[model samples]
Target: MTSFPQIDAVYETHLPVRDLDRAVEFYHDTLGLELAYRQEARGMAFFWIGGQQTGMLGLWQAGSAPMRMVLHMAFRLGQEAVLAVPAELKAKGAEPLGFEGEPVREPVVIGWMPALTVYCKDPDGHSIEFLCPLPDAPDPDFGIGPWSRWLQR
Candidate 1:
């Protein structure tokens, strides 16, 4: 028998931002994500985005302008939680930076995951998604399964 591999590592995500305090307030208040820790180092502020041990978000505050929108990070909202995402975004005064259909364009009922899914950008233009369980699908797959399966080529 083989032993299942466990991820014994801390996840760190670095995001460049224009304002650290505003970002902190938005992440904590609007998204309901709690702050774990913060650093006032020379040009950055590392914030833990969830509970004390969930993960950390690194904010690089060395620039006057907000970072570009070339890339983004996402989070899973489970099946039931996906349903409330749009309303939550609206309440937060956010407009979708992506399209209005398909994988990242719009929220749709995906046959692959059997859930209602929607993708959007955060205050710093990071892409995030929310998904609700499928109407008749069994179980759930949180991630894309494998890197190769996600490649377009």
Candidate 2:
């Protein structure tokens, strides 16, 4: 077998959007990802995720009559910030979601991964997640549940 370089981390991902400008505003102004570069001729915009060298996210314009798709991507954050996402997103008129994709009052802990996470949707309905791995041991038996419950365990 040919030896390939072991994978490290995801450097970038792209999402199709109905409007590049609106998506750029949501990702830059709302989500606070730093604007990296933009190509107006191609109707594309790129943003630095985490930091300039760590990760990048590309937003591409889906022209008229484009077929729709729902994609998922996550951003890692510190524990405290993950806990605050529900309220912060709500304040910005975005709905925070639990694992089941329903409106949530707080972040949920997916016990198998033991990660605290919350989800929101972009204007194009792509799933966006903010998460932080927990210090606790993995508890696959616990499945997924409220963040508060995880703390009491």
Candidate 3:
């Protein structure tokens, strides 16, 4: 019989925000992620995503109003699932600065990476990406690069 690995901590990350509605708009309406929960007491909101329990995002009503968020975040979307993200963002009034591929809307296929990635800036100026895994691509060294560099792989 085969055994599964013990589960430890799950989820990718939690992003802090000042307004739950704004975050929901950017993540849900703009990015197309489903809004899962909103906690008023905790001052947080969660987006619905798969792969792990609570791998979505968090909205916090702390600090000053939405300043330039220097952090970056990425999410996975399979090949067919990769479509409609940039269009959705543009339709919602967010411009896609650049992407991994061609002129516009051309999904960048990084030979060494496993994602066809498109880049965009959220309302808060934080960078976020929708990545669909390219399982056939050559495995790259994700550990050696800077935090942001990993996204380019």
Candidate 4:
């Protein structure tokens, strides 16, 4: 039998957006992602998730909102960077949201993975997340709650 190929990480993910230019501005300008390339003829734009070669996010011009699907994607960052993302997003006029999609002042911790995370929505309504793994041990009993509550554990 042939050995199974080892899948490392997500190389890329594609998203359909109503407007390519607006999506580019949100990913490249507001979120500060590195624009990898643009194919005007293809009606698409690509951004580097971490760096030039690490991971890629592609945004395709899908015409209308009704035709596009709302999706969610997470960007991994350092502990400090993840903590600061909410404030920076807010300053850019984006709302930092919690698991329930309510505005939150701090990041949240998913007790099972115990990862710190915060969310925001793109102009096209796709949910974008900033996340970091916690150094602490997992506590399933905690369920999911704010970062402060996680710290108290």
> For residues 1-153, could you state the per-residue lDDT of candidate 4 as single tens digits?
999999977889989998899889999878998888999999999888878668999999987844657999988899999899889999998999998898999999999888999999999999998989888888899998999988877
**Candidate closest to the true structure, highest lDDT:** 2
Candidate 3, residue 104: CA error in Å? 3.3
Q: With candidate 4 superimposed using the best TM-score fit, by how many Å does residue 1's alpha carbon deviate from the native? A: 5.2
TM-score for each of the candidates = 0.62, 0.94, 0.67, 0.93
For candidate 4, the 10 contiguous residues with the lowest summed lDDT are: 60-69
Report the lDDT tens digits of candidate 1 across residue range 1-153.
998999765477777776777777767777777566677666565656455577777766646544454456656556556656666766786653323422332355544555566676656656655555555543244333221222221
Candidate 2 backbone overlaps, count: 0
Candidate that beats the other on TM-score, 3 or 4, i.e. the better one: 4
Candidate 2: where is the Cα deviation over 4 Å? 64-66
lDDT of model 4 at position 153: 70
CA lDDT, every model vs. true structure: 0.57, 0.92, 0.63, 0.90
lDDT of 2 by residue, 19-121 (tens): 8998999998788889999999999999998788799999999865656788999999999999999999998888999998999998999999989999999
Backbone atom clashes (below 3 Å) for every candidate: 6, 0, 4, 0
Q: Which one wins by lDDT: 2 or 3?
A: 2
C-alpha positional error of residue 41 in candidate 1 after TM-score superposition, expressed in Å: 4.1
Give the alpha carbon lDDT tens digit for every residue of 1-153 in model 3.
889988764475677665667777888877767777888787887776772365767666556654545567777776665556667666788765445322344445444665566778765656787777666646564422222344454
